[model samples]
Target: MTAVPAVALRGVTKRFGASVAVEPTDLDVSDGEFFSILGPSGCGKTTIMRMIAGFESPTAGTIALDGRDVVGVPTRRRDLNMLFQSYALFPHLSVEDNVAFELRTQRVPRAELRERVAAALDLVQLGEYRGRKPQELSGGQRQRVALARAVVGRPKVVLLDEPLGALDQRLRKDMQFELKRMQRELGITFVYVTHDQEEALTMSDRIAVMSRGRVLQVGSPTEIYDEPANRFVASFIGTCNLLDATATGGVVRVEGVGAVPAVGATDGDVVVAIRPERIRLLPADAPGGIPGRVVEHAFLGDHWLAKVVVGAAVAPMQVQVPAAEGARLLRGIEDGAEVALDWSAADARVLPAEPAASSTRTQEVAA
Candidate 1:
């Protein structure tokens, strides 16, 4: 038998006044899965989360939780918990009391409430600090307290809204793993909202990419990063070199780059998206490749980034070289030095020239 999705949105949309915050969209998050809604601010990712939480009524369509329609449910009536970015722990309450707040409101028996509160604090490693107030804890500790409070009632779903946004880079990284671990231990579905690509990529089992109040694409991290759905996804997920080209008879021709193999391409204008690490830099006079001048280079911790301007292309192509290879390969290749760029034709994706144009029919090219 097919299990019902933990959270389902069918043709869901939201509008505020005359402005549409979310377009018609469909999404299903599996039970016990870690799913992320990723997009820039105002892209409607948070709006979708709010609607699902019953805090905002959708302008259209229906929302379901475990096969039951929840479109008109009140926020408190939904079988879920929400953790905000601010932590929101009461300054006057001790850690244990904060975690017990929900159970107390439900009037759970004292024995069970105490046991549940202790377990929640232990799960978050705050059992030893249960006597301390929110103001007595560090930023990370306070965040943990808020998380414990959210999950203490054992909600079937947890909605996290950029909860780690205020932490330092290192702390944020630490919490990412912590959050994933907690989710697995509890075996509850997590629908996280964030604008940070790295956070989404690192923790989510699947991600929904949103843009301009629409869901652009949804897929696993590898699929989202390596096989983007369109131009916007290609550029938004990572640093890519997008070059305009003309495809004709199984080949794409870039200005001054000659014809590159593009099998199954329909003759028309297209844009090629390739990762920096895929482009191999070579001596300008070497056999076959695009000739260009290295305009700049920067030394990153483990690698180097070089920008090369080629042909009639509008922008320079970024190339990533390993630290060891960079030291030897770029020994005397100073600014303005001529170089050649080459890559396996199969490494590049041929997308439509227009921004956000769907490329479901697009295929990988080969020599």
Candidate 2:
């Protein structure tokens, strides 16, 4: 931890005439760590990547690479590489040529260029595709070629802006494992930008949740998901059931559901946030439980995702039942069938009410 950070930003801000794309912010990416800047569209995630890649200059503040300020450095001189969502490979060049283009431009020796390009392609398991042009490869294979090109120079940090966004779900998942493996083996710092919450949670060592051109919270994946800093983070990082309620001593009382265990809030309006998987279905009319009815259900492979409307809950709360357990309980679980729901008090967290938004802007709870 004592080593100089691979990348650092101090009071970084970007202004595009009248629009502020990124607010003043401070960030430090540790050496060899997989760090992700996660947020929805237009939340400044891509602007952050552009700033780091030297494509866009910040209106204020400094950007340092390996502790050395590089505000005026051109992209080629900065010793950093950017991988875009588009492959951007030269159609005129073969895969090997595409991967070797950067090194060749740098005037690297022929033998060393060949060695580095081969090593990079091998790292991504694309050695055999070297002779084929990018137009001949599948989306996933072309992505690997782009990945190989990015790392052939062995930059200290690599900026990836939704490089896998174009692939299908199955291919994207497969690429995630391959990309993580490459990052670990190369021991390079990764500055990844993505809007996909699950991708960030699965691939990043640490994540910075951004919103409204500002950083809401920065922490490890577990901390960001389990102990989100605010309501924005709580609702954004995963699927959460947000229940509006009034907080009393050690509990939040719901209008129709009764008292619910809660903490860290005063005697006023608050919210209780719980994940879907943590809730359990109890026998109808069970003691210390809230009564509800199943209004909808869906089959999601390993588990059944169902929405239960409890009298005390402000809206239909989602519940996840294991396939085996769901089979036994689903006989009594149908549209309009009676049921009861209960969850561990520790599983539910108290959070502040959402901040009021400007009427002109679209209101959304995103993940």
lDDT of each: 0.88, 0.86
* Model 1 Cα RMSD, 1 decimal: 5.4
* Tens-digit lDDT track of model 2 for 189-266: 999999999889989999999887888889999899877767788889889888888887767877787787566768
Tell me the tens digit of each residue's lDDT in model 1 across 1-367: 9989999999997777666778788999999999999987767888899999998899899999989899998988889999999988888899999999999999999999999999999999999999999888999999999999999998989999999998999999999999999989999899999999999999999999987777888999999998887788899888999989899876898887777645445789988888999888888898887898999998897998999998888899999988888777676678999988888888888888888723222231110
In model 2, the runs with Cα more than 4 Å from the true position are: 312-314, 356-367
Count clashing pairs, candidate 2: 1
Q: How many residue pairs clash (N, CA or C atoms closer than 3 angstroms) in each of the candidate models, in the order given?
A: 0, 1
Clashing pairs in 2: 257-312
Report the alpha-carbon TM-score of model 2 versus the true structure: 0.94
How far residue 173's Cα lies from its native spot in candidate 2, in Å, is: 1.0
Worst 10 residues of 1 by lDDT: 358-367
